[model samples]
Target: MKTIASTNSSAFGEPGIFRGQARFGSPMLSDYVWPLLEIRGQRPGPRLCVSAGVHVNEVSSIEAAIRLQKLFDPKAISGSVSIIPLVNQPALYKYSEYICPIDGKNINFTFPGSKGGTFSEVLCDAIMNEWCAGSDCYVDLHGGDLRENVSKFSIYQRTDDAGLEAMGRRMAMCFDAEIVVGLPKDHMQRPGRPPTGFARHGRLALMSEAGANGLLDESSISFHVEGVLNIARALGILDTPMSAFRNARVACNDYLWVETPVDGEFHAEIEPGMRVTKGQRLGAMRNLFGEEIAEITAPETGLVLWRMTHPSLPKGSSVLAVAVEETQVGQA
Candidate 1:
């Protein structure tokens, strides 16, 4: 078992960066080594964990994380921050599909995993046990995958612990995303949820989304960087004041997912962040002969959270997700 050295030093009180590898699977099929970045701050405070690339196709999140690691100066901060910019190394290296090619599992859905399970599960176990076991706050950055087009949003899980739930909400708000989603506690308790993997263990956690089509954009990268800085300020890691925003943010408590009824080529008429009334036409699907196979419509008056960008979709695949607008007039 390879070990990472501690970064604490009392002489000049400067931040230390430690880069190391964590073992993942057996040597028979193939061994995997995951990279870890440990950044220790000058003064003592809470430990903030930021991770990206849980889904390898989310290029913007990975780019943002890399930029964040370079931009942060431990001399100006109070606590330690650990970043794992590329969690799914195999997927990133191979440019694999949405799931880990080795295990054919989505790492995001298999968190707090078993040590003796599949490759993805073992990696998840290592991250939970070694990296996030005692974290004070956790932020998982994500973007639209290679085949998705999504609007900017942040999500926090609803938990029984009021304080943890509140902290998660505050972090999501500090992100200043166009939309803030509060996932229901019941849904979080269901099997294979990512944020719940940390929240259920008493860690305050949330996720942010931006970018799409497996591409990197400057705007998306900047949005994620600013969000992390805001989170640092909100968590007291950074002494700087919180930044202000011009537009009022919207809060979403529920969302509807539209799935493909048949295998075909999809053509979307609406884009992310567009508001549509119930029954409005959103998209359509066509077969090779150009015959329309399906017509997707809005289930309710709400905001389009995400849409499928890849034209070819299998039956039952999700075409888009809509966040239902709340009737109340305050932030959730």
Candidate 2:
């Protein structure tokens, strides 16, 4: 491979680091670039790629990626680590919009994208094809957006590849979040496949979520930073032992999405990570005159994975996401 910033191919075989930008095409006014950080260890091992800011509003993940870039030292690792701290610079620069303003599409839904497609698609294409083509592992960091309040959790795909699935599970466990979700083969396939679409193309991939509501809480940021370091230790990239969290990891095989029954101002009575029983009241919707328009109830007993942070709710808008715990099928 060719060299870009400071480090060269020789550094890939020895301890060194490189910092540069992966340039894509230009917009009307300025050039498009994704900041890239590459760290090569003294000993050769797996190539672990970490990225965040796919959803620009997920600021905690972005900050975690930034902190992780400075924490890793090439002399202390056994493999290479590549980090893209902020993936959607345009969206991020545009006040943390959920979708790219240029194309009005969620970049996370566009994977293995087309070079000739819209702005988001072209950006995804460059990242997947040029930056993350071959890798032993991949972690897409995310958190709740400006209008999302969510608990910390990690998700991994339950794939046909046993080895890849196992690796993904281990990485998820290493994150040690409050919950570990196993997405089925067909999870989130509509609109477009998630970034985990890389798994179908033969890469061990996982995603971590923390922080929410466009706030940068230090606790949330620390959780993500520690999760990445824990995964590194699990992968043997770092010699440090795994650190345990307070809660035992809970596993979920599916999620239930609750949508608003009427358009009104929403007031959530429950928070993420809270447990709810079937038929329990989760929140309520009120009309403009402050009259109760509808009551939001839990569909089943489960943990609240995420809740809508926005005060106003439109009819049919998703307000809460509950992760249903159940039996584990197939081989781990």
Candidate 3:
């Protein structure tokens, strides 16, 4: 891997693999450049980019990106795949969670950021304007932070373009995840959640999640790695016969969270991907004396997507979250 300096156009100009470091937009961090891996297949086709670590604490997704950077060969079927293993470089090194340490902003929400903006914004601007350019399809990898107990899932930010939305849904279901969902950008609007600005990029983008609590579990890592490969196969980015589509994928437009009204030690009786009916006791909030202070019940019948794995619960903490507002797209 030579320290080659190449633009995105030339990076994908010809059929080959290029690996190097690209400069970070932050002048304060003048000494650091983010790692970039570009692989252009032998045949001309779509350009797919896989990014991770916007929330630097998602260790498994980051590890999977690192593995994917080297997994592809130049002789693969068609198109190119760009791997950005680490996006929030400052937060990653400083051990920050969801937000960037330098700018105190969650890089997740700041899309198509500005050059004159904060550290997080500048980095985000590069991702949306530069890295995401010429990408036919984009996949952003993320997962639970240090305090979250998230199960695997994928969501494509719904767009007005019907074709793009359909492709995004296909991309979401092509992976190995517990479920998949499609919701408008206005549904949970925080700028844009899928790395690139959907309106600006005008391309297919989806977010996939696995792993949790900053743990580098191999199973989670494999989930992400296989997910990307499966997508590449389904999208014809790799040299495979392409039989990796997960035919059964559930969709939920909104989530119903089971929260505690008071601070107490929490006990969760359900895990992610389990089915629960309304009024079912999902967990309990107990006092220091081991008294059941409150019973956490499901407000709706749905699938459990995520739960609070930690026993310590603060006031208004969500013990378990169920995927409500569901639409059965296919059979499992």
lDDT of 1 by residue, 117-147 (tens): 8887877767777666677887889987878
Report lDDT (CA) for all predictions. Answer: 0.77, 0.78, 0.75
Better of 1 and 3 by TM-score: 1
Per-residue lDDT value at 55 in model 3: 85
Write candidate 3's Cα lDDT for 31-54 as tens digits.
Answer: 557788888877887788899988
Model 2, stretches more than 4 Å misplaced? 1-14, 24-30, 188-195, 328-332
Q: Clashing residue pairs in candidate 2, if any?
A: none
Backbone clash pairs for candidate 1 read none
Candidate 2, residues 1-332, lDDT tens digits: the string is 23356443333334687787666543531356667888888888778889998888888889899988888888899888899998878776686567877788888777756767788787766666667667777788888798898788888877787887788888888776888887776753532333256666766777888988888888788878888888888888999877778655688776678999899988999999988877899999999899998999988777899998887989998999888676533323
- How many angstroms is residue 16 displaced in model 3 relative to the true structure, after the best TM-score fit? 2.0
In terms of lDDT, the poorest run of 10 residues in model 2 is: 1-10
The per-prediction tally of clashing pairs is 0, 0, 0
**Backbone collision tally, model 3:** 0
True-structure Cα RMSD, model 2: 3.5
